[model samples]
Target: MILVTGATGQLGTAVLDNLLQHTPAQQVAALVRDEAKAATWQAQGVSIRVGHYGDPASLDRAMQGIEKVLLISGGGEDDALQQHYHVIDAAKKAGVRCLAYTSRALKDPSSLANHLMVRHFQTEEYLQASGLPHIIFRNILYMDTLPLFTGPTVLETGISLPGGQGRVAYALRSEMGEAIAKVLLAGTCDNRIYHFTGAEAYSFTDVAAALTELSGRQVAYTDVENEVLAGRMRERGVPEVAIERTIGFMTDIKHGQEDIVSSDLATALGRQPASLVEGVKLLYKL
Candidate 1:
């Protein structure tokens, strides 16, 4: 069986949906924290396993006879590391033959935002030492944080923190999930570490232009310093920890740290990924 952790989430759901196209629904299982949230998946004939990163016992039960598990990185609190360890331990005990983990693109373990990737490395270590075949996909940044992105509440404030023109090889989260689904069902590619990325490169300036075209407005890019940006967010009531990390990572990327593009994602899936133009049309309903 193939098990997808965090199946109720956006990333996990994309994987589940794509996997259904490549494999039978009955052969798949959605490992979600809330069974109630998965009524549609259950009604569609896919097995629903109630589980959470915080609950090792539930993960154990969910992985009873599973051969492959996709450990989606859990988001929240200082305990994310501990909760991930619990899930990894359970997967080991269950004797799953293969495991795939969603991780960020961190070439340097000593980089500023490498803390998150470090945890993924820890999970990779557990999988390696446990004699379980594994695949670690160090993914590039998501394109969802584009210039046109806006929630109902945030749209009123207009665009914020429009950085001073830096290029990021931002891969679509859907493409990442599709690649994961492809690997899971292929039943090969064991003990392989892959770098998932998009085909083309783009800058925030390009993103702003696209947003102006899509939204048909006079939106423009605005650059600000790290400290001033953080202060503004703090004054607006954003959480301190989140604000700090957000600025840190953006600063890391802005200075040409995240400018490279790779073909690993295309090579793994045997096809090209969506370009920024394509991604925006789909995401922005344009």
Candidate 2:
């Protein structure tokens, strides 16, 4: 059976949805911390394995009877790196035939965004050393997060960020999940890395133009200074950690760190992923 960790999360849920379309529910298992949250999946014939990334014993139990595993990256947890290590170690011990990990599509190790991706780099290294057959997916920024970056009143306030002329190759999180599910179902590990990114890179100015066309509003782009954007976020009561992260992301963009583009996602899906304009429409419901 194939198992997916963080099955209740957005990307994990999307992967499960795609997986169920091509495979029987009985062939799939969900690794969740809370079984109660996965009651619907359990009712649908998916084996619900209760486990925590931080708990090796629980992971061991969850790994039972599972030939393949998808280790979804943890979110915002302080000990997420250690938790990933635990899961990798357990998967190794269980002798899983293949393991897949979701990592970031970052090219520059010295970028300010390294603060966010250092753990992913470490996890990738650890996974490589674990001697388990593995496929590493280096995913780019999610179009799903564009709304968070743009804010609710983006149409009214225009697009304002510290990201200068830098562009990002943003792909939909659900599409990435679909591609990942395809790889999982293909049952090939091959110890290869795939850079899951959109076909083209786009700047905030491009986003503003797309919003203007889609919304019929004259949306504009404003590249503010780093401190200026941080001050605005502070005024909005955004948390310090989040503000720091946002600044780091913008700084990385300014340095062209997120401009990498690749065709791996399209090759996996057998079709082109959504364009920036298309993604913006889906995100805004326009």
Candidate 3:
């Protein structure tokens, strides 16, 4: 059976949904920390296995009789690396034939310029050394996060961020999830690394223009200093780690870390990925 970790999460749930379209529900198993959150999966005849990255025993149990595994990277900075190690170890013990991971798309993942990139690189290195057949999806920034960065209403406040003229190849999370499902269903280990990115890159300036055209309102892109934005996020009670990570992402973009475009995502789905404007319109109902 194909087992998916973090099955209740947005991307994981989307992946499972797409996988179900290609294969039988009985051929799928969902590894979720909370069985309560997986009621829908269970109702659809999916095997619900309880597991957490922090608990190696639970992970081992969750991989029982599973041939292939999709390991969605865990959240948070603290202990996330260790948690991934735990999962890798358990997967190794369980004799899983193939393992796929969602990782950051960086030219040199080993460069320690950003903490998030560093963690992903570390995990990638560890996974490579584990001797398990693996596939790595080096995913770009998710368009789903656009709503979060845009704040409550883009039409009213416009687009404001610390990134300056930095372009991101942002793909819809659901599309990327579909590509991942295709990979899992094909069960191919020949292609080790795949960059799942949008067909084009866009900056906040482009975002503003698109919003203006879509909403028929005068929207603008305001560039704020990193410190100023971080301070504002802090004043608004955003967590310390979140503020730092947000600022770090903007910094990475400014340095051109996220300016990448790839057509592999389209090739996997056998169709073009949704454009940014189309995704935004659907997201805001514009």
Candidate 4:
């Protein structure tokens, strides 16, 4: 059986949906923290296994009879490392034949200031040493985050961020999930490390232009200082931790950590990945 952890999350749901198209429901299982949230997958004939990353016993139960496992990276900047460690140990104990992990594609994942990147780097290293044959999908920055950066009032406020000329190969979360599903269904791949990203890279300026055209409004890209953006977020009552993380993302982009273009996604899906403008149209309801 192929078990996918975090099956209820946005990307996870997409992966499961795509996986169902290629494989029978009887061969698929979903590991979720909340059984209530897994109702949809359950309705679709997917066996739902209740488990938490923090609980080894639950993961053990979930991994029963599972040959291949896809470990979705858990959230949070601090406890995620430990959570991933727990999952890895449980997968190893379960005698899983293959393991796959969702990670970020960066030139230097370890050297990044982003807390999430650091945790991912640590988790990748842990997985490497676990002695299990593994595949690493180094996903690029999600196009979904573009909406978050532009905000809901972008048509009125324009695109305001600390991101300057840095370009990002922003693949849609759904498409990335599809690519991952393809990889899983293939049984195995020749390459261990897959850099899943959009076919084209776009700067924030390019994103702004696309938004303007899609929205039929004069949306401008305003590159502000990190401190200025932080102050604005603070005034809006955003938490300090969140503000710091968001700013760190902008800093990473500005430094070109996310400015990557890879055909891994297209190669996996056997089709052209959506461009930033097309992603914006769907996300922004344009």
Candidate 5:
């Protein structure tokens, strides 16, 4: 049985779509916070288990009868770290053979240039130490950060975060999903770590140009100080840590820390990861 946590989420849903193409529904289990949210998934024959990272009991309940489990991370919450560890513990208790987790690219200890990286590094470390068979997909920054460019708010307001034209090899979450499907099918491969990125690198200028071309609007990239960006986010009610971490991701672009393309996803799924322009056109109808 394959138990997929966060089954109702964007990534989770996409993973399920790919999984179903190659596997049977009886072998799949979906864990969601609201069982009601999975009504559509249930009707289609997925076993829906109601659960949440906040509650260990919920996770424990959902893991029952599960063989492989996908532990997708949740948005930043006070208990984010604990929640992740909880899932690992629960998976252990359920005696799942393989545990697949979604993680960030660049597992370097000093990669905290962003908040997500810090959490991802910690989560990856915890999973490895758990003595469980694990498969981790260290996905690169998502292209969906496109909203930071293509949307009316950023364009209309002329607000650009401080990437300083740094290049990022951003992959589409769909590609991540497709690669994850392959991993799930491949089962647990004894402490496997896959570093997945886009097939090419793109700069912030590339993003700005794409938005300008697609929307026929004037969008300029402005270099704001990281602290200023964090301040703005905090004023808008974002937690301090979240702002600090998110602003730090800008450094990945500025320093070209995220500029390399990799063939990992292609080798894994027998196809190339989507290109930046292709993704923009498909998503924005440009």
Candidate 6:
């Protein structure tokens, strides 16, 4: 059976949704911290395995009888890297045939986002050294995060950030999940790395134009200094740590570290992935 961790989260749930379309639910198992939260999946005939990345014994039990596993990155918490190590060890101990990990797309090692991505890089290195056949999906920034980054008042406030004119090949999270599910269903132990990115790169200015078309408003983009944006965020009660992370991502974008475009996602889905306008409409409910 194939097992998926973090099954209740958006990406994991999407993977299961697509997986069940072409495979029997009995052949899939979901790993979650709370079985109560997975009642719906359990009702749908998927085996629910209670586990957590921080707890190796639970993970070992969860991996039992599972031929392939997808290890979704843990949500940012203290000791997150250690948590991933625990999961990798458990998967190895259980002799899983193949393990897939969702990681971020390539970025410059000296980029500002390095602090945020260090764990992913470390995990990739560790996974490679484990001697287990694996698939590494280097996913780009999700189009789903546009809403959070732009904020609710972006239409009114215009697109003001420190991202400059840098472009990002943003893929929809659901589509990424779909692609991942396809690979899992193929059951290959190819030990390959896939860069899951959109076919086209788009800048914040492109986002502004897309919003203008969808919302019928004259939305505009303004590239401000990092400090200026940080000041605005601070005034709005944004936490210091959050402000730092936001600035780091924007700085990386400004440096063109996130502008890489690739067709890996489309190849996996057997079609071109959604465009910026399409993603905007779906995300903004336009």
| Each model's Cα RMSD | 2.6, 0.9, 1.3, 1.2, 2.5, 1.1
lDDT tens digits, residue span 1-286, model 4: 8899988888899999999999989899999988999887788888899988988899999999999999999987467799999988998999998889999988777567676678887888999998988999999999998888888899998988998888899999999999999999998834399999999879899998998999889989989999999999999999999998999899889888997788889999899999888999999999
Which structure among the candidates has the greatest TM-score?
A: 2
What is the per-residue lDDT of model 1 for residues 47-91, given as tens digits with 9 covering 90 to 100?
999978898889889998788889898885578878877877888
Model 1's C-alpha root-mean-square deviation from the true structure amounts to 2.6
* Model 3 steric clash pairs: none
Query: Where does model 5 exceed 4 Å of error?
Result: 149-159, 212-220, 227-242
- For candidate 1, what is the total of clashing residue pairs? 0
Error at 227, model 5, angstroms:
5.2
Best by lDDT: 2
Cα lDDT listed for each candidate: 0.76, 0.93, 0.88, 0.89, 0.80, 0.91
Candidate 5 positional error at 267, Å:
2.0
lDDT of 3 by residue, 1-286 (tens): 9999999999999999999999999999999988999998899999999979998889989989998989999898489999999988888899988988999886555442467667887888999999999999999989888878888777998878988998999899999999999988997886388899989999989888888889899999999898888887888899988888898888888778888888889999999898889988877778
* Residue 217 shift from truth in candidate 3, angstroms: 0.5
Candidate 6 lDDT, 69-151, residue by residue in tens: 89999876879999999988999999998999999885675555638677888899999999989999999989998988888
After superposition, which runs of candidate 2 have C-alpha atoms over 4 Å from their true positions? none
Against the true structure, candidate 1 has what lDDT?
A: 0.76
**Candidate 5 local distance difference test against the native:** 0.80
Q: Residue-wise lDDT of candidate 5 within 22-92, one digit each (tens)?
A: 89888888998888888887887999998788889988898888889899988877679889999999999
Answer with 3 or 5, whichever has the higher TM-score: 3
TM-score of 4: 0.97
Question: How many Å off is the CA of 58 in candidate 2?
Answer: 0.7
The TM-score between candidate 2 and the true structure equals 0.98
TM-score of 6: 0.97
The 10-residue segment of model 2 with minimum total lDDT is: 107-116
Which residue pairs show backbone clashes in model 6?
Answer: none
- Once fitted onto the true fold, the runs of candidate 4 whose alpha carbons sit more than 4 angstroms away are 189-191
